[model samples]
Target: MAFGSVVERNVQRPLMRLISMGGAPILQQLHLEERLLRRTSDNWCIVNDGTAPPTIVMGVSGKVSELVEVEPVLRDNVPVVRRFSGGGTVIVDQGTVFVTFICNKTAVTGLQPFPRDIMSWTGQLYDYAFSHRKFGGNAQSITKDRWVHHTSFLWDYDVKNMNYLKNPKRAPEYRLARNHTDFLCRMNEYMPSRSVFTEGLIAALSEHFTIQQTGPETALSHDNDFEPSTKLLSPQDLQDIISSKESSTVQRVPGWPQS
Candidate 1:
C-alpha cells in the first residue's frame, strides 16, 4: 500500500514526541519508560538515551544468581538494575546508545501489540534507518492499550565489562555458545559515527509520523503517579540472593557434563 493510504486509513497526522536524554542512569531510564507508559495517552514517543558509566541491566523476571557473577560485581561496586520490561540481561556503558518508542495500540496500522510483532516492526524500521550498522538488539513492554519498544546500539565497549555477566542458561540459539566478544560487534567498526546513525533514525521516522522535537523536562512535567516494579540491586541485595535457597534453579543441558 502507498504511504498516503497508510496515513489516511490508520492515522491522520499522527504526532510523535522525540526526546534526547544524554547519559542517564539505567534506573532513571527505566523510570522514564514507566512514566510514559502510564501517564501519557494516545501519543507516540521516542527517547534517545546515552548510557553513562558501566551498569548491569536485567529483565524484570531475571534472577541475579542466574544472570550475573556476584563476586566481581560486588568487588567492583557495579550497579545492577532490573528494568520494568521483560528482556535478557546486558551490561551497558557509555558506549551503548539507546532508543525507545512508546506508542498507542493504533499508532501504527496492522501492528499488533505483541512481542514478536513489535520486534518485527522495529526490525523493519531499523532496516530502513540504519542500513550500514543496524541496532544491536531490542526488547519490549506491552500493555492493553500501549506498548514500548526499545533498542540498544553498541557503538563500542570494554571487553572487561562483559565478564560481569554469566552465560545465561537459556539464550537464543543463534548465540551458538559464543562468548560476548564473539557474539557482539561494535557499531563504530561498521558505521561512520553516532551522529550519523541518529540522523538516519530521525529521517526514517519522518516517513511514519509528524515528529516534534521535545526536551526531557517537557516529558516529565506531568504529575508523577507511576510506580515501577523493578529495582536496582544493592550489594546487600546481591548477598541476600546468594544466601536464599529460592534463587533460580539451574538446568543442565541434556548432553552437557554436570558439575
Candidate 2:
C-alpha cells in the first residue's frame, strides 16, 4: 500500500494554480486578472477576484446607450465599465462572489473546445455549492487553445440596485422578460458562506485535476495596462451614445452605407 501511494505521488503533477484576491474596484479586478490570464504561460488558473463595490460592467460589444438607464445611472454616480469578453451586463457589489476557471483545452483531458461545454463543466461544480438555487450568472471568453469561464454568484445583493439597468432588447431566450430580478438567484439562499462555497469548489476541482493552492508571485492589484472604461467615458462618448440612440429612432433617407 505504501509503495503504491509513493508511486502515485511520484507521478502526480500540478494541473492548476489558485490565486485569490480580496476586495477592489470592479474595473481593476476584471482588467488586471484578465491581463494575467493572457500573459501567463500556466495553462490552468483558478481566480477569485473578490466582490467589488457597486459598479456595472457591460460586454465588450455593449453599447452604453442600450443596456443602462443613463441619466439615473449617472445621477446615482454609478460607474459603467466594459469588459473585453462577450457577455451581458451585470451589476457587481460586495455581495457578489466571483470565481473564475481558465485553462488551455490541452490541460484538461477530453475537455471540449467550446464555451457551452466549458460552461456546463463550471455549472456542475457550482451546482454543489448552490444546490438548491441556480442563481449564478456566467460568462466566458475563448480562444483556439484557451478559454475562461467566470461567474457572479449573487450572495446577498441589494435588490434595489437592480433598478439601474433597463430591459435589454435582445434578452436571453431563457429570460423571457426584460426583467432583472427574474434572472438572479441569491447565493446566500443555498450556500451560507463564501468561504464554505469556495472550499467546496476547491475540493470538487481536486477530483478532476491536481489543484495547487498558491498565491501568485505578484498581487492582483499590481499596476497593469488596464484602464477603467468609465474613466475614459468623456463628453464626446456621451454625445456619441445619445446620438447613437437618436439616429436609430429617426428614419433615415435612403443613402449608401459609409466605408
Highest TM-score, which number? 1
Structural similarity to truth (TM-score) of each candidate: 0.85, 0.78
Clash number for every model?
0, 1
lDDT of 2 at 170: 90
lDDT by residue for model 1 (135-167), tens: 376778898899998777788889899899998
Which has the greatest lDDT? Answer: 1
- Tens digit per residue, CA lDDT, model 2, 53-129: 58887887887878887656655567677776778888888887777777777765556968778766665565523
Off by over 4 Å in 2: 1-14, 44-50, 128-134, 216-236, 243-259
RMSD (CA, Å), candidate 1 to true, equals: 7.2
